[model samples]
Target: MSAVVLSVALSASASADMFKPSKAEQMKLGKQAAAEVRKKEKVLPDSDPRVQLVKRVGRRILSTFSEKEQPWEYSFDVIESKEVNAFALPGGPVFFYTGLLEKFKYEDELAAVMAHEITHVRREHWAYSQRDANKANVLLLGLSLFGGRRDVLSATDLLATFYSLKYSRQHENQADSMGFDMLVAANYNPDGMVLLFETLKQSSKGGKPPEFLSSHPDDGNRIRNAKTKIEKSPKEFPALTKINL
Candidate 1:
């Protein structure tokens, strides 16, 4: 009856494509995207306190990945921006915005954010999205060439579709569930994910919404979903603990 369960019932169809991008391909695409981001955003130094804390949380999360689930290489970066946003690229590139980092006083909350982003990579959402786009374009191109159909959806439509892709609600919920499991497995507080969602909801009240909330929506349902997941997780978590950065 939960929203997460309902979402899974509706959207958890197995993808039909069997030829997803390989790890090398994902790493190549990630490196390219990361370089473009680096050219525009100022990268924080290794010694910056916020950067250090993010890296620590990132590594801890990375350590919890199962062997077969390990990404090619994990590299976390702090971007110098005031907008509250963060994201992970296809392979292992993760970025955090300074505006977001300054708001967190504990590593658990930070871990929540990083774990969510990491789930996107581990789940191969980006590569699958790209694969879908490519298939559509190829089919459109073929129809134009062979079937003499030029009035099909335009390239602009394809671009719009790609950019406008909000990860399905099911994937978002799965990320929350997996991130909760990772927190419990690694001895971090699962409540941080819920706390992060609450903080995002609060910050969006008086002003513009944080950029993080744009792609990763934080409706109350997701918070409740995380709470349910924590309560039911099979991991034998010890007494929940909190740590200051």
Candidate 2:
């Protein structure tokens, strides 16, 4: 399908998924998962400037969606840890770590990051991935029972892991595309998505990849895809003045 058609399809049915968890269930799961994260990690107070900054950007993105467009109860929080990481739960909860937050040099760049994570939730990526992985595991279980070989089970388990990771990478790409549309619709710089991936690529040089990249598409491919969208959709995504970080 053409990019324009795909974009329209995504906008029209952002929550459509073949997964088991319904939107209400996703919301409940997100709330429970968020609570567990808060208990295990040191979440910065809402009063903190960092937390407020993230919320400010998050609110701008949320404003682009009408009540009917967004069924999830969106919330944003910052963690105290130094890991270069951010993630969204099943529904609308998004978390940013200090290390990753500090790397952002502009508001649009931060918006790029937040929008990508939020799209994962809006797209029900976790629920879809979990359901698919569970199915694969069940098959593996059946194989183990019939064959009764530890080595076969272990190999199948590894194959399942590989499939799960590959599926996650596909989700990462989807989130990138949807999030780029969102960033522009929210009147943030369309280039922010490309800029963010370029920065990530630079950071991953000559070292272990950031935890953030573990399940994401290759940075180079993401950057290129974002640029293509920007170039192809100038009318739909008008350029905006970028705010400094």
- Per-prediction TM-score, please? 0.77, 0.76
The lDDT of each candidate is 0.70, 0.71
Writing each residue's lDDT as its tens digit, candidate 1 over 70-133 gives: 5577789999988777878778888999888877756777888888888888888776766565
Candidate achieving the largest TM-score: 1
Model 2 stretches astray by more than 4 angstroms: 1-19, 142-167, 216-219, 236-245
Candidate 1 lowest-lDDT run of ten: 142-151
Candidate 2, overall lDDT?
0.71
Among all candidates shown, the one with the greatest lDDT: 2
lDDT of 1 at 242: 48
